[model samples]
Target: MGGLSPAKRLYQTIIHQYSRTINCNSSNHLAQRLIQEPISRIKTTLDSETVNKSGDENLEFSWDSLLTCVHHHSPPKAQLVLEWRLEKLLKEKEKNENLYSDLIHLCGKIHDPQTAMRVFTSMESNHGGKPSSNVLDALISAHLSSNNMVTALSIFETMQNSDDYKPTAHTYNLFISAFANLGNSKAMLAWYSAKIASGFLADLDAYGALILGSVKLKRFEDAEKFYGEMLEARIKPNAVVLHSMLVGFCEQKDLVKIRGFLKGVLEHKWRIDGYMAEKLIGFYCELKLVEEMEWVLVALTETNHNQDLDTVSQIHNGLIRFYAKLDRLDDMEYSVGRMLKQGASFRSHKDVENVLCSYFRAGAYDRLDVFLEFIKDSHELARSSYELLVAGYRRAGLCEKVDLVIKDLETQRKE
Candidate 1:
């Protein structure tokens, strides 16, 4: 076993275990013993056995839990155990229902999906155990998580062709969400329409997901149409639906549309959270609507002085960038000063710091000076401040400051 490959070792271990457990002359006694022990005890005993054998603390016997654990566990070691056990089962070719049920459960438990797929495939190839829709569902889920939508789709389509294997709305919903995330509105809509035609009532979440996908695809009209149909179907739009609509408007850069959406949200008496406000502010910034951006920023600050710093930092950097591009030194100074006064958060964001560093490097030196003055001794600038300070002095033609920074940098390097 020591000289064998990990896969071979795993195979041997699984074979040895299966032989010891299943190949007894007292098969009835083993069954009685299993029945005597509660399922919980059986599970705990199985887990303990695996842990002791593998000496891997994270190895779990439950299929789903084991998937996550074995993923981060040693792959070769886990794969060996899985392959060996599956191979031994295949070699047995027994009609023992208990053994088959255990193998099916183990098929689900195997962490490496490729290994699971192989075992399932092998069951179809050599073993007489039938592949169930649950097996297909597992494969689809694993592939989708890996962003292998094509493989998921193939499994789905294959499952659909089997007259005995009718997919439920849950199945279609899974595919819809997957396609929507990939920005494939056409496929999402197709599945959505198919669900409708099949006389399945679309859940609010499903409609919301499809509408959101439409928004991402820039099909605002389609999204609006869907919303109308949703209302006609007597389904109330949830906060998620409204947020997706707002996002759609933002994507279109249609401030008027977004205003209308926001007005509707207000009419519905929904409170704005940081995410929605951030989206609205981001929309204005994207369109370079500086006045609108300022208004939104001030409104947010007044409404909640302790609002999220990440959003404020985003709004601040957007203005800094706008000013830098337009060469509006006065506006830049005003924005930086306002930020300092408001105690804006997100001065700590990596992108914000990079933008500030760029501003200094590009001889927006006055703006850089203001930012450094404001951020100094602040927690935000504790990191990379030395580098920016060095860059700043180099740009300002301060040879003494540059030399001191360079010497300090070298000393830190050695340490």
Candidate 2:
């Protein structure tokens, strides 16, 4: 009777152990078993079976099947399987470049630099294969993943010295991102400068990282320079890049720059998401620039057709509050109406009070009555409106209207 093939035997062993652990209701134990047992035993069992059956030194273990079997496990365990398989393959004198790359990447994923370097060395010494760019990337990424910038940079420098391996854009981006993560703008800029000197045009991602790193280091001038370079390179700035610039401008209170950038953004038809729009509006509001605020709000609302209800509400709320502050009652009323039309509610009593005061000061009693009627069902807003009206009536010695507002307030409270 023929026993199961080595691959099938490994699969059945995994399944039986998994089922056994599951039946015992110990999922953690099952996980431990999955991670610890199968790959460890697979090599020994297959080796013994192969020797006993066919006296064939080459084991028929399937790398694809092994990878598939361990695909669902955590990176560490998957890495373990790959390591075991690689060790066995090396013993069998099998030289697979792809397998070497796969194991290096697996080690990188787990940030296992020690193991990754071992795999790199083994690929050279044991398999007699020159390290490809893919393997080098994996090794560098492993160091980056571990946040070991020194070692990563060392490896990168080694790659630069290699006659055969030229670092890709991805390699430079990883270095840039790693420096940015460290908040070392100088180091990041150095990398960018090196990349430019290498005749590599900075991609949008690289530009963005430099812009953001400059902003982080409070080098707003450098950030602007990078942004200008990006534009000159004809790489269109996305919302993220533009927003970072906007925030940097706002931080410096450079309204002139902000207005210019916003004009270009609007003219270019860049997709302005709600958060960025809201931030720009907030800046305009803080600067007390009503026209700019209104223009940005209208442009963003028109452009962002997919704006969610909450974002719309926030937009209207900002407009209403700003208009109320400027005593622009008509604009406030328009914003409120727009908000209502968009299925958003105004809940700011302070804004409602300001609107009522504006209406009273302007002697728009008829409009006030209509506005009151519109918000009559809103208990808190109506109460605030009535109180403001009552206060105004009392100050003007209109005792009759004061009594009337007080009576309406009492009636609403009762209801």
Candidate 3:
């Protein structure tokens, strides 16, 4: 069905593939299948035709693997499939707040808060279930996520007035974290104050929110103070808290602090994703701390299981950027060679352009020949490698040294 929407297509596929096993009239097991398994193994209990009824024969159908082949896709696409499935299942399931809450959270994640609100409102009247704090959080998250401020606040007011439920510390932390993300430090601190006034001792989560807010607002001192308080209270900082503080320190170019804390992070081997890897590497490069940069790279390499290719690529590109900015052609070539040796890629076209621009800017036409020859000799350049050399010269994407590049590029392409 090329004409059908992605979600609708998934629904039809599931209907055709597993119609014998699923009961649309029952919600609980269906909802569990939606979440607990990918679409491939959504059916926990199989049919007689699918499995051996007498338990004497091993069925060789491999329906699960076949379904996996049908449904295997990117995470967001899979989530969309689940969302449509949940929407249909919600109408059939009753007296299961857990499922309802989970579906509401998924709605929030997928940016369909209106549907989440519909699911929330339907919980008691239609499903005969009393909504729990989990449901409340999901409902609030859905509204806040969509920036439906007035409606979200109205829901909060209703929760406050409810005799059956009261807003908990976790609830307030949700608001705090939301405001922090929205870059509204004032509102974030207001929620933090409200949380404290409610007599709930601020925990790691609450402090993490405050520090994140402080960092977003560039109030480095405030972030430091919150971090210090967290340590004093003997609450171990999680990745978010530490990363936020580290980011603030980096922005201020506080190399001393980065050195001390990064040591601990490496010692504990906390995971660093691409963005964080880029930031740390670029920060060290700014300070001309090449030895420290190398140390960090080596450490990351040693703990490379946590480092994805994108993360490793960014690390290499950051060094390339530093060298390009300074016209350190020899050092840049050496860094690139080292990266190739380590099996990391120079995937960023911007970095490649930066290198070409540097060569042009420095008038190092002779050295550029060696650099180009060095890269071409690697024998693994992607398709755009020639375009950046040949097409770049033809289009003036790089200038002042085009003749030699063009000649060499044409020769390389022919051979």
Please tell me which predicted candidate would have the highest lDDT against the true structure: 2
Show the lowest summed lDDT stretch of 10 residues, model 3: 17-26
Off by over 4 Å in 3: 1-87, 110-114, 148-154, 157-163, 182-187, 193-204, 231-239, 281-295, 298-312, 349-379, 391-415
In angstroms, give how far residue 228 of model 1 lies from its true place.
Answer: 5.1
Shift of residue 184 alpha carbon in model 3, Å: 4.6
TM-score of each: 0.54, 0.55, 0.64
Tens-digit lDDT track of model 2 for 1-415: 1575433332233234323432312333333445556655744543453353457654334444444444556555566655675687688676777777777766666566667766766665455545666677777777787886666766676567666667777788778877877789878978887887888888998988888887877889999998998888889997668878988999999878887887677677665567676796678887787777767667656765545556556667778888777778778888878777757777567767877777777777778878878866642655666777888888777898889889878887888
lDDT of all predictions, in order shown?
Answer: 0.61, 0.70, 0.68
Q: Candidate 1 vs candidate 3: which has greater lDDT?
A: 3
TM-score order of candidates, top first:
3, 2, 1
Best by TM-score: 3
- At residue 375, give the lDDT of candidate 2: 69
**TM-score for predicted model 3 compared with the true structure:** 0.64
Query: What is the C-alpha lDDT profile of model 1 across 234-291, one tens digit per residue?
Result: 7878767877888887777777776666555445445555577667656666677888
**C-alpha RMSD in Å of predicted model 1 compared with the true structure:** 13.1
Supply every candidate's count of residue pairs whose N, Cα or C atoms clash at under 3 angstroms: 3, 0, 0
Report per-prediction Cα RMSD to one decimal: 13.1, 14.0, 12.2
Cα-based lDDT at residue 305, candidate 3: 64
Model 1 alpha-carbon miss at residue 283, Å: 5.6
